[model samples]
Target: MQAAEWRESIRNKKILVLGLAKTGVSVVKHLQALGAIVTVNDFKPLDENKEAQSLIDENNARVVAGSHPVSLLDEDFAFMVKNPGIPYTNPMVVRALEIGLPVYTDVELADKMTDATIIGITGSNGKTTTTSLVGEMLSHASNLEGQSFVGGNIGIPSLDIASQASEADRLILELSSFQLMGASEFKPHIAAITNIYGAHLDYHGSMEEYISAKWRITANQTSEDYLILNADQKSVFGERQTNATIVPFSSTSQQIDGAWYDQATEKFMWHEEVVLDRRDLLLPGNHNVENMLVTMAVGKLLGVSNEDIKAGLAQFHGVKHRLQFVAEIDGRRFYNDSKATNNDATITALDSFMGPNDRVVWLAGGLDRGNTIDELGAHMDKVHAMVLSGESAEKFQALGQAKGITAIAKAEWIEDAVQKALDLSNEGDIILLSPASASWDQYPNFENRGDRYIKAIEALANPDSL
Candidate 1:
């Protein structure tokens, strides 16, 4: 759609901006600029909401704060632009859908406004890392015709970034299933599903629903577009759902048609050609190796040279909160992996430190989502001890007992958890905070949870401040 045509379509039309977060605020400003009559609706009270108050005071925009009353639909809105985090099961969203009003996340709006070639990435895990990898790779490439922009679920709201993007730019987005569920016509030139696992069951209701939402990244793509998938996922091969040409990546086999790790040569291979040496990568784990395979596929698909890809990979240590190394107090090395919000991520983190001498004092637990600890049992052999916390603490304690782990401690808060972990640990043991659950029980997001762990580590390092 032409930018002029898309803008004019919403002109003079009443649009509802649901949930006044960063994405909601950006959508409201863009809608207002497009001459649309925007009504910003948020569940936060008007006095408590700074974003809503700012819109009302500065731009004189219409807003309904405090509650998502179904009566808001009486305004005859053209469509509803919802915050990605707001589930469709939400009362207001359900009502909006029942009324046959079109609903979308900011992605759809961003896609309509920008002419940039969108490269969207989504999966159960590694979305942020792969998105950053592709973004970094493209940024280093001299062959690219224009600049690259990274946003979406990776912090920056896509609307403003899309608005600033020129036709020559590459918009690399790290999309969450929550965001993807609401995306309708948000097709990307290059769409990638890093891998799929059972996640967000509370929000999605079922594993099937969650996978369907993740696959929506390619809903509008045709044969012309590229869809990079994990070849390691045998189920994905059986469930081919996209028209886009599939580019598969794997950590197990080097013969994949897309990208793979050549064990014999000890190199990262794109199709058949080498991209980067495996030993050169500083990031730990086979999961990161899988991440690199996906990243290289994207870089190669964008016509980026192997040298440029290597340069980008070389510069990247790792993203914060994902297996980030903290201070080594005495002989105990602390690693913050507070971003592992699911069982699979925690499993990966546990498996990564399986050295004969590298015993793990695993710090875990957070918001309980009714997860069974059975799957985690197999990966706990290397975990010499466990420090549990949050809503899932008791559940994890059972796992600790079942596994016959020597040391199992529970703490009320993250700081206490860190101290408990330290108490359980001996010299040379790795203290890891790889909570296999979300942080919503005690913290707003994973970053906050990770930050708390880091702060606690600092406290342990400098006892004088205490």
Candidate 2:
């Protein structure tokens, strides 16, 4: 029986959830009803996550909330559901794998639990925008089961409900290299890579390691499967062999196949066949153009009609925290780009930094993962001034000032960073929070960082201050 069936069964079972993150909480909620006793563990202290406290209390499950202990897995339950964020080398998880207990992510659970035809999207950047676009493009994608869930990596474990999904329709998954690295017996019928760039070197420990993980999207496909590749990715643009039929998309060059950029009109040429006005895309930046092409190709391959694709793209709103606009505060616009955790993403954030009056007070820096900033150097002049924070703050400040790009270093906090950006920003200036590093130093993750930035900006905007 699948998770849904097991939950309703009278037989009690033991299951260990290896992380108490957001997805873990959702999985716990569902498993509790299935008569499975779940023990939730994490690297943070038991009381660290206040939001999770109420959940732990309600679920009545044992909590090993700080630093996963190998002892927790001591010959434990039938299986373990690993969170995507956890690394492969984790000692506790490694021990579980050695014991021959099945270990998998919420994605694998979702895949096994549901009969939905999965369309998995992964790449170094642009995944969130592309995933949301594809999900919006074909809301009608439904499995014979008559239901579908669209999520993964971008937040929400869409696969958690797979076992009980009625429609189990088409699933549009936003996959990450980290998530793909640990997967086994997991394959998407339709897979796409928006583009790949230097990112997550710390986790993978090398660009080669990173690229190897990205390629897993198409590793297990059969000839009937569809593989969408971004022709613009120099690392993976050319010379590819896969069992799946290949579909390519790009915004930089026009060549042989699936999707190409029409430089003249700034629109996407589908199948190198039809053109859609680029300006009509709701998302901004050259990066987004590349992402939309992937979505268009996948959408059409999945049997979505041209009209349905148009409807989805036209109605699609960009994902939150990826250049999400809050509002104008004190004549300065605020943007929450906490999703721009690495240099490649921040470059995309900066690409969209050009303001109406050529003014941008950039808020950059965080737990620098060691990805080089040589690429962003060319856009220095576009940033009028930078308000820096986090461990990488000083380094970026030095780089900015050295390049003669006006810069300032501030205490490592979003409030201080926002205030400093505002102090230096003039009317028509954009108060941008596009930190180029991970937010783990002061926040749980990017979402927490994005939330704090939004809250701080709101408080400051309405302050009765001096």
TM-score of each: 0.78, 0.71
Off by over 4 Å in 1: 90-100, 236-240, 325-335, 338-347, 355-466
Candidate 1 least-lDDT 10 residues: 232-241
Clashing pairs in 1: none
Question: 1-466, model 2: which lDDT tens digit per residue?
Answer: 5444544552366788877667877777667765677777777776677645866677677777768778777744888888777887888789988899888777776666566688899987779888888877777434223544578887767556454555346777888987788677677899988777788888898877788787877877999999988666655544556798888777778554787778776667775566477666545566677778888888667666666777778666577888877767778878788888877677777777553445778888888777676677777567778888888887888778877875565766888877888888899777778888888887899999898898888788777642
Q: What ranges in model 2 sit over 4 Å off?
A: 1-11, 43-56, 64-76, 140-148, 160-164, 234-241, 325-347, 353-466
RMSD (Cα, Å) of model 1: 4.9
Model 2 steric clash pairs: 7-34, 43-67, 142-169, 143-169, 145-166, 145-167, 146-167, 147-167, 147-168, 147-169
lDDT of 1 at 161: 85
lDDT of each: 0.87, 0.75
